[model samples]
Target: MPDVEGHPTREEMDLRTVLNALADPLRYGVVSALLREAEGTARTCASFNLPVSKSTLTHHFRVLREAGLVRQVDRGNNRAATLRTEDLDACFPGLLDLLRANP
Candidate 1:
């Protein structure tokens, strides 16, 4: 199946893109929190409690989505995000484990 709007397909996900998205501290924190959740759990962007403006947060999500590290969908007035853990694991084995180990 195709991915959500603005997200790359699993086969299209690139290691460089994923790494670059996680390179940002804010985005990394978002992913880290999502990683801690049960698989397939979805959290609204605001739930992350990021200390950035709405526009900035939106940009962060966009980066993650485009990198194929996240899957986001509009939920009423909020956008909810779930980490693409399965996809990430399929594309790059041990990547999530590395992130978990380092953080």
Candidate 2:
């Protein structure tokens, strides 16, 4: 969970990192889902219903978190995730829109 806890700050995010993290379709789906999800609500990872294995899902989540596209918080015994919508909008402007439209 150390890497999970090491999410990049908004100011630290770069276009390259974000795009690289999203290179996979699974990761892209993750962001797309978050974009439409309600704000201030963190969804559990299992709720995504990805067809990948557990480790694959972890890889996707780690990439999104490290890229600063998502914020994950530990809630009781589980982890919850939410999109960093404002941060991405400020950094890349309309990137989320593109993802939502394309995904």
Candidate 3:
């Protein structure tokens, strides 16, 4: 499938991208929110419970998308973000499991 931005599909997303995307506390929070929601359920940009500027929020989402930690969909006025559940599982089978098991 085409990426959110209509870019060509990447053959594979990298581990570093996943890790770097999740490294930030805010981005982590965004990931957590997605995890709380159902699989493939797209969440609005305003759904994030963070105290950041609009530009900053956009930046965080971009990081998540580039890292392949999340998939974003353009919905006219706003964008929706969801976890890359299957891709992540295939790339790092127990990554999230370990995170949940530890944290």
Which model scores highest in lDDT? 1
TM-score of 2: 0.88
Off by over 4 Å in 3: 1-10
**Superposition TM-score, candidate 3 onto the true structure:** 0.84
Scored by lDDT, model 3 comes in at: 0.77
14-96: candidate 3 lDDT, tens digit per residue: 77867887778888878877777778999988888689999988888877787777778889999988787887887789987
Clashes per candidate (backbone, < 3 Å): 0, 0, 0
Measure candidate 2: CA RMSD: 2.5
TM-score of 1: 0.94
lDDT for every model? 0.91, 0.84, 0.77
Tens digits of per-residue lDDT, candidate 2, 1-103, equal 2243977877789899999989988888878777777876689888999998988888788888888888898888667889988889899998988988887
**Model 3 lDDT at residue 77:** 95
Q: Could you tell me which residue pairs clash in candidate 3?
A: none
Report the candidate with higher lDDT, 1 versus 3.
1
Which has the higher lDDT value, candidate number 2 or candidate number 3? 2
